[model samples]
Target: MPQSSAQVTAAEISRIAGVTRATVSNWRRRHEDFPAPAGGTDSSPLYDLETVRTWLASRGHASAATPSEELRTMLRLRAQSGGSGTSEGLLLVVLAAASHSAEELTAATRLPDTEVVDRAQRDAESAADAVPATGPVRFDTADAAVLRALYACVRDEGGQAALGVLAERELEDSAASGAYRTPAPLADLLAGLIPGSPSRVLDPACGSGTLLAAAARRGARELCGQDALPVQALRSAVSLTLTEPEASVTVRAADSLRADAFPGLVADAVLCNPPYGVRDWGHDELAYDPRWAYGVPARAESELAWVQHALAHLAPGGYAALLLPPATAGRASGRRVRAELVRSGALRAVIALPAGASVPLHVGLQVWVLQRPEPGGPERKSVLFVDTAADGPAGPPAGFGGTTPPARTRGTARSASVDWPGVTARALGAWRAFMENPDAFEGEPGVAHAVGVVDLLDDVVDLTPARLVRASRAEVDPAELSARVDATRGDLVKAAKSLARAAGHEDWSAAGASAREWRTATASDLSRGGALTLLRTVPDSVRTRAHAAGGEEGRPETRAVITGSDIATGSGPTGEPTGLYDGTAPVIAVGDVLVRAIANEGGPMARVAGEEDAGALPGPHVHLFRPDPARLDAWFLAGFLGAEENIAGASTGSTVLTVSPGRLRVPLLPLEEQRRYGEAFRHVHALRAEARRATALAEETARLLAGGLTGGQLLPSREAAEVRGQGGDSPH
Candidate 1:
């Protein structure tokens, strides 16, 4: 094939066009002008890339692919041209392209094919110098289109986008088992479990470096990661570089348990979400490994091996947080190791997170936080156990009262839906409180508890947080419980009234047109025109100092940080202020529009900062649009920008869609008209908040009433008997 005649499979065409494979098949069958097969078998015909582009353009379907998708197409084409297994080489080129500015990338892609390859090779060499065990980076004429795609992807989307593309392609090709990306929010929660700031961090079995990236966000200056797959290691390196360019990052392609890439190195902290339930994790071969300070992990105890590996890499007094299958905590095979970990004080806390938090979504994963003991530190006494399984964004988890569970995806058993932000807050609040004063730790009833090490050395040695929390809740004071129930009932009544009022607020006439349409401008255009100011969190290193100083020197201090999750959940700012008066952190003001950087189906993605959130700093995962009041209404912008369709259109990525703030469109409207819309939006927000509050209160009330009645703390009133006799419904 000619160097310029890069051919792509029909599936690749579908990806390029952002359409389904069936759609591509339909196009091939129906469109007479569709390009003929350039190569490949009858079942999997390939089409010329340029020809396909031309046809798609004629059909008004050209350039529909996101940067990542485009990059994937080019990588596959390069692999085809390079004979085979050169996708890794293309990945190197992608990384190199990511190192350059958009303008530089554009200029480089315009070079002759051979020069593009040469430039990519040079860039790859420089980029790969930091990664260990990475062989020489090479490229040829086969990589021409890939080089262009890499450049364009890096220029338009981001280095992270390019890395994601490369990782997806590599993982798909390798057929890597048990592969899943850790949700960013979950990763953040894991990172937050570490008590103090960690200077150096390591993720022994880092998968695409999500946990390490979260650690970097917490001001970790040095990042070291080892993944068995070379693609994952390379991806991690590139992602870390893009996320925190100043950090010293070293990612190696090796099984940390088998190869121990950084054998002599210890880090200030470790964060990992290692592959689970691997029976052949070199268990027998490495039975006597030094990393297994707790005990030799059995073949069935692979998670234990990973846990010990993480612990071994942590410095004295440093913490290692691992996300593990709940089986690891109570499996009889791992009981000895679990007992020893507790006895030695290395096991600090075992938090049971809600199901649907990550992959194997049916199982509630447990976060094991361990701290390496100082040579002669005080002997460990207790382990904090937190069960946030029933936690939600507003209050307790929804669907109480034996309600039929929400429909779940096939092949996965129904698991309680997780309120990520609420769970995160609950976990962190308990962990931090315990860390501050372990000896005096007063556990939250039905949520968290501190169990004595002696108490946990039983035969079962199960450290499941739910078990401990259930026991704690069972022992709560009846008087206190009664008071809480009474207070909750009062609150529920008030919330119901508020919801009723909001629901009954003035209604507006619908647009007469069959479909609503309006001229719109991108956030970037509005920002450029000085109609609004956009702000995001600074890098961790700077943020840490600002947080430490309660803001930048001489700047106004913030009381809280409003996160994307808070906006999605209709909650007030949930993040504690870094107290960093750094002016770099945008202080949210009332009337400022806040949009979540991530898009999910759970809730609204945008909200206007209200009095409750005013003076708060915008969190890293939130975008702040401070519109000029004279020109724009905050709620009007929020209403349009937060529309589900708008978010879906502006979002990028395969599973977790990341919103591009600059791409968010807002309809232009006069201030007076905008306020009219804004008022309606405000009422809608109020109604939603009130509804959530009412639901939460109702669930709480039902639980309390059931528990109180069953435990004989309260008896049914005479009115209930009279109502039942009068044919009225009885309170269950």
Candidate 2:
């Protein structure tokens, strides 16, 4: 007899699998060899339990693990063919029996063998409702071990190296978003800033346990982390477990602010990367908290409150390292806290990391390393301030640029070149030297300086990075700087001139002088005519990644995922990308005008290709518009789509900006005019590419120069560049 429909969704599989209902959705992008539908077409497939297990087994290459072995036994009783009441009846009986067998196995694994056989016989009899529809299947235990090892290896290596292991299962989940985990190198540097090994390390609002994990790696045993989100807790727990299995870790799921889970818990070290510019944080509840020995936190002093909380958790002589928004240093609301902290010598050093180190990408963050005031500690005198911001002119890398790359196929994370090793080494070395003998540690010009507390209490009370780092060589010739700027400007102007001459046969000389009225249509209208197509609607199976660019390595490879909040802002994906799709296979063809489907105004927009961008797909968050070459010129469509008219009209959503494809309209200009427009587009792309390359080169130059100068690799000289050139001529 076949099992009944009641056999499918059993609690046993749901519990041990630790998989969510959403993970079961094989909607589209990956999961190529998913189970054949028990009853439905490819468009709406639904697999029976036995078939799903079988399919899962096959992918694992037949492993003799507990689940795989049990699955084979269950498959033997599934319905062979047709909707026989026998098969249905048998399936239900088998499931009920299987449930009993599971409980027995759990107990038997810890009991005698005789009892196991007795339980197996009882289960077989009860499962008489099940029939042998399929033959027996077996797997080797060694095979399952190999699979586990492979998975572990890839995760340890990185996403690039893990592609093979990840290929089998989809990874377009939130944890796998383009958000770069803070490099362990930088984390170690921050962790080393603490004087010695702390008995307990607490990371409030820890994201994925990066800093805590790093602390553990550096020999800290007791680790504790807390976050506001359950997902973050889960991810952090998993990551921490994977990184430091021997170390004790306690991860709590609660807002660090509203609910103080570790209240009154003092630690040797407290590390945090708190939320920025968060107005909704519970300031009122914590107003009278005893942690505010530094000062009472004003309404706008949310960061100060966090600082105090970290300090409260610090034992005597313990230290706290916090990554905070720069505004907190000089913000009026928190001035008292800053004053008291510095005056008491609880504040140790303030280091300014380069821009794009973390979020608030435009405004570089400051690392405030503070020590708990000890009863009779060595009387503190001077405070150290290291400003490494404006350290470089870094931006996104080749593969994931805001604009398409020249050789599109060879894209890699932009931060691959960011010298994290050099940065970390320099910071750690300086810190280590200072710790060894504070008096002997002298500031290197343009890098680090130690100033007395009295000197810092000036009128401004400002701790801006620019004010701390000594000035570099004064500006080069203004004429030379202006010439470089003019050269760039001239190239852009020339490209515009070429575009005018090429588009609509407009005279190159007259394009700037003439103004003419013309008929136009919305991009939405043009798309409706089959003149273009948008590949924004992703199927359920496809996985995508979205991340913001930043970290130690300037601009890391990332995709901007949309959230519900994003949807409210404008027309775009409302949340983070959730699945994986083939990057190269699903290529966005040339002439596709890719715009952020959702964003506030000044949202980024770019054309699909330049003469160089071949065989590349738009990363997530972008909506690709493919105009029919027969009807519309790609470049012409790009220009029109990018214009304010199309952007504003297509835009939708409240908090975020979004545009329905049906609503975007464009000009139905003549074919010749469209071709001319296309030519202009090509020139514009080239100019943009040149500009981006120039910017990258400049940034690279700046980073190398900063590291060299600050690390004492380059000696001070009036003409540093000239000195470097002359040194290159000498032999070692």
Best by TM-score: 1
Stretches of model 2 off by over 4 angstroms after superposition:
1-181, 360-362, 391-417, 471-732
368-453 per-residue lDDT for model 2 (tens digits): 89889999888777677776544443222211112211111111222122233334444555556566677766654455667777
lDDT (CA) for every model shown?
0.76, 0.53
Q: Which ten residues in a row have the lowest lDDT in candidate 1?
A: 401-410
Alpha-carbon RMSD of each model: 6.4, 18.7
TM-score for each predicted model, relative to the true structure: 0.80, 0.45
Q: Please provide, for model 1 over 1-732, each residue's C-alpha lDDT reduced to its tens digit, 9 standing for 90 to 100.
A: 234678888777865665546567888889888899988889888788899898888875575666667776776666657633255565666566655555687898688878877887787776666555566666777677777778887777666667667666667421136457787789989989987789899998887888888888778889999898776787777777666667999888888888988999889998988888788789878977888899998889999998888888888999999999999989999999999999999999998877777877778899999999999898888999988774223233222212212111112333333556667767887788788889998876667789999999999999888788767656667887798789878988998998899888885786786867666776767887899987755433324433445743435454688876577667677676432234656677888888888775466788988899888888867888989999998888999889987776566556556776766778887899999998889888888888777877777787777767765666789987887878957555
Q: Report the error of model 2 at residue 285, Å.
A: 1.9
